[model samples]
Target: MGTGTGRMASVLRGACMVGTMVLLAACTRHGHEGYARYRTNCGICHHGGEGMKGEIPPVSGRVDKIASTPEGKQYLMHVLLNGLNGPLQIDGVRYNFSMPPFRAHLSDEEIASILTYLATRGDTRPAPVFRAADVAAERAHPMTTTMVAEERRRLDAIHPLP
Candidate 1:
């Protein structure tokens, strides 16, 4: 740990921090915050939409179908605001994991943006875009994570994803 080595390390760290800030700022300025937020918050676990060997579900097809309907839209928004747990099955695959709620971590617009991002990730016919108000309405009447799971079940029964 010579002085030169320490100084070089510090300089590298500072450069990395500054670069990250600039990248984040660009996303905000360019209206790519949804993609940025998803990468920062959800990408690790979901592997950027590819599930981790079935422990997680890809945020594609099924969610797109869900977001397309009114009840399904509300349910998805609730899941976003309150979070969801698993022992859940989707499209014949079983996934067991806990999804922490983002009610506090994200603003209404941010949540809508994430949802909109997910909804358009694939070639989902009639991709539905989310409004911040859609998220705000769900945020107002907060549902429990457990309640969200129940709603998922009801939604599954009524609108079972293909």
Candidate 2:
């Protein structure tokens, strides 16, 4: 083969390799197939109604307001791991919802992937990537029941639940 042709072939091969790697990484980290894990578990109550009165707020667009800030993201992650049942105010709307914690139900990596999926597709906020390390650290320092009660009191102080 001519030197020029050989160089061109090498370039094409390199480009093809890069493209394939990118596609594989994307498939592994995102899109429809990426949702299989969450759908099987969290989608149970998060997607819609359960008729439990004050249980399971739809996890779709409702997370937008909270997911916009780091504190909010932390709060959501904490709640998912710790479970919160009481009053929650989102964008001035009160939701008397109770969320069952998933600490025991899911591994840190699994929870992180679920959070990433929700942040990516469900909310308008910037995609929130919950790394397994973050999950582990957060799980290690869980929000105590007392802390949750205090948080509620503080929120109520600011915006009384109706």
Candidate 3:
């Protein structure tokens, strides 16, 4: 009876150890997935700040500024979903470029995750998850005349006064 009980104890301990390892592996994988998602999506446009036409400003070091403010958050989300054209001013420099909206291309969760990663680590926003519902609602709203106008007005107000 004693030998049998010892064997069971060893087996249980091994199982617990394996479970812990599996959980750890899963967490590591999730982290990698977040990074990969950013690379796959935002990497194309904002990857290290090389704009498509040498007109877009470098966004690599500007993630913090973009993520840290209320208006900044709105602007980033709007640009991501709707794209920006005309002159865009940030941190006193004008990026006289237009970023086409990405509403049809990316889902909110992916945007959220990419923004969260970039803002917190890359841009250093300090608080990254600023516009969760805004992104969601914008994603749902019709991209028509009235809705676009309202959103543009609201976003303009929120954007840092240049």
Candidate 4:
């Protein structure tokens, strides 16, 4: 009886461990989905948001604040859909890499998820989540990478980043 009870206790402990893992996974599923999308699409350029100095701009620390505003939000969506070219300054560093457009390969939903993933990273402030509808709105008016750069210039003139 004692041996039987010990075996039962060990089995119960294993079951509890499995249950906890499942619950944790379930809780983080949406975030994981966004993260996975980011990995597949944006990670190549951004390097998991760390970014290369004087090359790719880091999105993890900067995106949340920019995403909080209306124009900033639109700019972000446009950048993702159409990509951006030419020199851009972030944190006083100039990066001239031309980002390629993702519209041909990614769906609106995937873009929204990737944006949401980027916006939430390393940010203390509440950032607005991008939705598929927002992507669709931007998709309605497609912009070339050059056009995206022009729009970024206009947006930066209005809302200069600190």
Candidate 5:
């Protein structure tokens, strides 16, 4: 609170400006296509960000660690672009299902945005690492869903994800 009326008005204006900025930033992050596309492509299977009875894996609250490493990032890129199939395990649970690829359906940027969104969803001051160029670089080595699964297998063998 300000002591004088002039000071009070200035403080109120400053506070309102800050509030507006935060609101806009939040809306931009949450309402952006990254989230909407994620909902469309992933939310159904990963209902509420959790796995579906050990079939479809959860996409939220599980990516920060995965996005932290070089190999993990590579695995994530291939998984999204190529679609992961065959047997998979997470948190000591066995999951044998196919994750449909979006290489044909989505652009490199779209995929990048989605992965960036996943990696940074829990971040308060989100700084995205995934980029269209990164996706494009991986795009050069287009692997089948099974191959993507193998990539993940190799990644896990070297660096286990949590």
Candidate 6:
């Protein structure tokens, strides 16, 4: 009986150590508060920024470019706050899904963080960090998803994808 109990204790310790390592790795991979917020709020569709190619546009590499310009920055803020309904063509691929509005659920700070995370990942160019103030300003003048889409169209005309 003593031998069996000792073996069981050893196995339990080993299992505990493995669990701890897994938890630590997960935390390391998703250490930023913005990354956590993004996983909870946007990852379902965006898939941790990889996106669903041909359906949802990838936010990682591409968002940095879009967030570089003034009007483009405003467009991002509007899209996050108002959500977008589309028939939108990104890089010649048309995505016809609707992105649900997060204005009611997320605060300006959280939205800013998520956008910052999206804009910074896997990018070489120096992009401006999105601030809570920027989001708050956009929130002051609420636009519908349709309006956001129109703004996207205008921006697209000026900066067509390569």
Q: What TM-score does each of the candidates earn?
A: 0.77, 0.68, 0.59, 0.80, 0.78, 0.77
lDDT of 4 by residue, 58-157 (tens): 8887777788788888988998899889699987889999898988989998998888878778564565688999899899999999988888788789
- Per-residue lDDT, model 3, residue 23, is 92
Off by over 4 Å in 2: 1-17, 20-34, 48-55, 62-65, 91-93, 123-126, 149-162
Candidates arranged by lDDT, highest first: 4, 6, 1, 5, 2, 3
Tens-digit lDDT track of model 1 for 100-150:
999999999899888887887767766788899878878999888889999
Of candidate 1, the 10-residue stretch with the lowest lDDT total is 26-35
Looking at model 4, how many pairs of residues clash? 0
lDDT of every model, 2 decimals:
0.83, 0.66, 0.62, 0.84, 0.79, 0.83
Clash number for every model? 0, 0, 5, 0, 0, 0
lDDT of 5 by residue, 1-162 (tens): 547988989989999999999998975875486778788887778766777857877777667678777778888889888898867788888888888988888888888777777776545245446778989999999899878877778878888875
lDDT of 3 by residue, 21-125 (tens): 999896566546546876876667666444444455665555666556666666567667776565545555666655666678877866666666556555352
Q: How well is each residue in 1-162 modelled by candidate 2, as lDDT tens digits?
A: 999999999999999999999997885766453377668777776653122334545565544445565666666678678877756554454567656678888888787777776666654645666677878888997776447556656644754422
When 3 and 6 are scored with lDDT, the better candidate is: 6
Ranking by TM-score: 4, 5, 1, 6, 2, 3
- Whole-model lDDT, model 1: 0.83
Whichever of 1 and 3 has more TM-score, that candidate is 1
**Model 6 segments more than 4 A misplaced:** 1-31
C-alpha root-mean-square deviation, candidate 5:
3.9
The candidate with the higher TM-score, 2 or 3, is 2
Clash pairs, candidate 1, are: none
Model 3, position 89, has a per-residue lDDT of 52
